[model samples]
Target: MSEKMEVDTPTTAATEEKKAEHVTPSASGESAAEHPDMKLAQAIHKAVLMSSNKIPMDTAHIDTLKADLIKMSNPSLIESLASPLQWDLSTVDIAGMKTANETTLNELEEKVKEAQENAGDMEVLEARIAVAQFAAKSMSKKEALAMYQLVLDLPKLSSGKQMDALMEQSRVCSFYSDTLKNKDYIAKISKLAEESGDWDRRNRLKVYTALQNILTRDMKTAASLLIDCIATFSCTELCSYPNFILYTMMTNILYLPRTDLKAKIIDGSEILSVKDDVMPVFTLVKCLYDCDYKGYLQAMVEVESVLLADRFLFPHAGYIMRELHVLGYKQFLDSYKSVTLTSMAQSFGVSVDFLDVQLSRFIAAGRLTAKIDKFGGVVETNRPDLKNAQYRDMIQQGDLLLNRIQKLARVVDV
Candidate 1:
């Protein structure tokens, strides 16, 4: 009985040991509710679910992937997994390469043909028809007889908005250089201007261009051309107007500067006479400032009488008088008791240093005797004898002074 009891006790003990091994928990035996990794994964899944709910899920694949990502505790792995599923650009195929190539070639050919049409070769321009084309291209349909010029003959060259651009260009060019006046070039330019549709620009060019030709070429040709152009352009329906250059030229060559010409001249009473212009005024002032004593005295007397008689026409009288004083014009400065350096500088729009230089030079040359004013801010000068001698010498020697005097004489009504 004792042996049987011992055998049963050993088997019972072995059975109890096996049961204890099965009951004891392993490291991974924690329930999903208790495990920290599982809890973190669940929390991440809930967060991802909430966040992704608002975002548009474009595809079933994207929705499935987003659900999987929410379940992943390791968020860093999402980017690596996501890169493949995102927009697959390789699936798309573009097909315009051949079409684009054909289009570009056609455009390039058109551009070359257009260029050839506009830019007649320079060697070709040496020919008659080519030169005509060149001129026509400039004048176009804008003007009837106005031949415009170009920076170059190329159609792709510069742009101009005016209808008479070609005509103005040709005129400016002809004036700038004498070499542009080839007989062939002139004929071509004239023909081009004649073909232009614009009546005004055509007439203007016909008149001015003819004058240019006359001045540079021959008087007889100019006179004949002018008579014809004036007659053709004289019609009021064609926007006729008197050409100043044509009138001046005709007066010089045919009519002469006699009593009639003087009588016909525009006066200060006219709205915009040449005498009232800044150029003439400046020319007069510059002559006076250069110490042309007799010239100034004579011109001054003439100008003053005019100013006094026609004060309305001479609004700049006070300003001019002030400049004379500031420039150290002793006669005028002494004549006007109100003359002072401050007043002179204020009115003349010139620097005091310039005035000082003029005064010092005049004084040093024994032209005038200058002394500082009571205020210690200005200098004054006067000497009638010096003014006369200096002016007479200036009139004899200075071409600029002579031209200015002639210009003034031409502009003056008297």
Candidate 2:
């Protein structure tokens, strides 16, 4: 009788385990329920989902992105992910998604509870992290953020786990264009990565910081960071390698000295690798480097089209274009003491009057060190003398030092 009861107990437990495996309904024939790693699934789904929001250039691209999102989001929480897009219900099994969402959440909650009851502290933390990642992928932004914060608040969390949570939070903030929160999260991640000596995370943070700086119009800092990461860029979460190179080219072309631009960008292998993929941007840089003013202006139009179409670069399109023109004009003027307005205008593929007005505005604003001779129909360069500038700076610093010394003497006397 005892032997018979033991056999029956084993059979009953096996049956229940098999039934539990099938509890979560699979949506659209995808097997997300069977996937062991929720983070992997989330990363795959997020790559497509976040990209759809960033590349809103054309209707065709938008439609394509939406389709990809729908395909990847299946078997997870499709309804919440697709609800904002107002996608057609006929394409997805809406009823099945509701069941799947409920089942997945219930299963995750059970895992967390089970870990707390019987497992060690690390196991409980892992279970909670899984729940948080699932919420990030399937739930609304508010709920997802709350879940992540819960995981972060857990005691004895390692630096790596903390960084992982903060990075996911940064992605959520980025999706909503919550720049302030995203910046704060990245700063926290930066500090943690530095403390833990996580070189990969540190490198990835450079790209993240560069994107924020670009959006904020801090081109000098953005340009430096972007240029530095060209050879070791691994932040595919933010953009593709080709698109990363495009950004590097665009920002560096505006701020880098000719020698540095030539060495770091124009001659760099990474930029050359993607030259064909981003021809207009490549042309913009090449023409500027080669002093091909006419081609540079023509390429600027094409590059501007791309900039205006991009969601990230659109806001600063006008500013970037103006700066590029200023750079080109300044470079052209540097080679000669003076050049005729008609000749300079012809070189830049612009009208004399238009170039005159443009150069006048730049000169008046102190952006360009040149004088527009309306009477002589020439533009004279006023390049500052390095020696005289250095002398003036030294004298100013010396006077300031003497004032500081005099103040120190007065304090000593007192």
Estimate the TM-score of every prediction. Answer: 0.23, 0.78
- Report RMSD (Å) for each prediction in the order shown: 42.4, 11.7
Error of 2 at 302 (Å): 0.6
Off by over 4 Å in 1: 1-169, 179-184, 192-197, 214-260, 268-271, 278-414
- Which pairs clash in the backbone of model 2? none
Please give the TM-score that candidate 1 achieves against the real structure. Answer: 0.23
Candidate 2 regions exceeding 4 Å error are 1-58, 65-103
Error of 1 at 1 (Å): 99
lDDT of 1 by residue, 225-314 (tens): 554453334322111132332232232223222243233332212212433432333234434445444454345545543333221213
Local distance difference test values of all predictions, in order = 0.38, 0.73
* Model 1 global lDDT (CA atoms, 0 to 1): 0.38
For TM-score, the strongest prediction is: 2
